[model samples]
Target: MRKIAASLAVLVATTTPASAQNAVDWFGVDGLEFASPATSFRFTDLDLRDPHVFLPITIAPFPTICFDFTDNAIPTTTVSFNGNIQASYNSDSSPADGFLDASSLLWFRPLAQDGRVARVDNGGADCLAPAPTSGCAPSATAVATAYAYASFAAGTCLSSLPGTQGSPAYAPAIASPAGSCFVTAPKTFVFDNNGTPLTLIDAQIAASFNGVPATALSNGLLRGFLRESDANQIVISDPALPGGSVTLAGPAGRRQRQLFHAQRQGHAPGRERLVVLFQLQRVPGDLHRPLSAFGDHVRFTEDTR
Candidate 1:
């Protein structure tokens, strides 16, 4: 009887499917919310049309930005590509700490291709003329790339607990560390000699989350602060003059804003939904020819499924 039992156990182990052993179930859909005011600078004689010819241009900040994770699953291990996920525990020290990680891509496009150049002249000669133009006729555009980083406590905020959403439960709050998750520093060279180069837009961004709830709640609320530094710059390559470039730098301006996220009720197991409201909170800074007032506000929703 013992030999028969051993044979049965061996058969069952061998017949188990590989997929069942490695199956991973992720929580809800991941998302993002972003917005900023309008700011800019100007450059003269870009095309060398005249000695003091000037053109006014505006900077392109993300007025509304979001990412969708509808087709992807939150991974249990570190992943790279369309999305990424990471988790770790600090076991060496007392009061062990846990972490949940996620990241997404950020991109900036020219506000308006046709409007990039406020105005241009050929120094009384057609710009397309073969070789008889009097002065330089300059044109410019901007581009940029960035990413968003967020980390949460795995054991506290993202843990699996039953009958906790309806109860008055609180989890440990998480805040952004003192390092930039998104940076466009040392300047990205757009429109270089390299084939298909991107335009560059320099922006200093600061973000944080406050009063975050540790656990899911039907009426959970959190405050978010997003600030764009005044020291923004734009770099454009001069196609007319090979190896030549133009840079637009401006003084400190303000575009401080608050974002709100409300937790959804009746969430499924391992899934949560959040609705975010985006709005401008403040606009205080110098307004010169290049810098304009803030634009419209935006809002959106995010889900974890």
Candidate 2:
């Protein structure tokens, strides 16, 4: 009996799928867009002329990369490209600890109006159009499938579970017209002959604001983007960094109005609060052009540092 049980256990172990052993699920929106550019509000600025940027974000929490999953009849509706799973999550959006917290799922083509999660699957169903050769996803190597991002704000009320959304010292998706910290510093720069930036620094760092006082640093509204120090919204290749070097540049993402975002919060007297509108990411071209990823609606967490 022991021998037989041992053999069965080995068979069961071999037959079990690898995914069954995992516990972590990774789905973070690496970069987001919120509002139109400076030239927005014009009727003609339909955002149709820009090249779409589909960034494949990778989070280290889970072993596998984040992919799309549609559970039926839940508030997590990341529906699209048509297999059209009937699922939804309770997208009752509101602020939690000053930041935008909700259950909005993301889908390509139409922007998300509810839910908190954003998902991306390898596009496949687009090939199943009436013409048979729809050239979508797997059928075509490169498909310009545009997706709608989550829109949030510095919500007035708190979410049901305010404790879950962990408040970090430095949070993102927040900016301000008041401090204009980014405008005052020399954060943005052009690429030199060696494919390296002339000067790259963070907008949030204290030293960047050389003339500003400690009271301002301690109490001012700052750009909450964690990567603003090196990787701005308009990402590019830098030879100086270990893996940021860009050998060949591809077509740039729509530089105009791809900024999607939401979240903002009040700061403590000696801490930081966010005031930006939202988040956005443009392509790797034109690093010299100053772009701030349109800022952040931001849950402004108090950055103690």
Local distance difference test, each candidate? 0.17, 0.18
How many residue pairs clash in all the candidates, one count each? 16, 43
- Scanning candidate 1 in windows of ten residues, the lowest lDDT window is 6-15
Cα lDDT of model 1 by residue, 1-305, tens digit? 11111111100000112222211122231212233322211111011000011112233663432211212322232221111111111011111212111111111111111211111100010011111111111111211122222322211111112221222322222121121111111111122212322222221121212223111111111111111221123232333322343332311011110111122244333222111111111111132111111112211111111
Estimate the overall C-alpha local distance difference test score of candidate 2: 0.18
Worst 10 residues of 2 by lDDT: 41-50
Candidate 1: residue 83 Cα off by (Å): 36
What TM-score, over all chains together, does every model reach? 0.15, 0.16
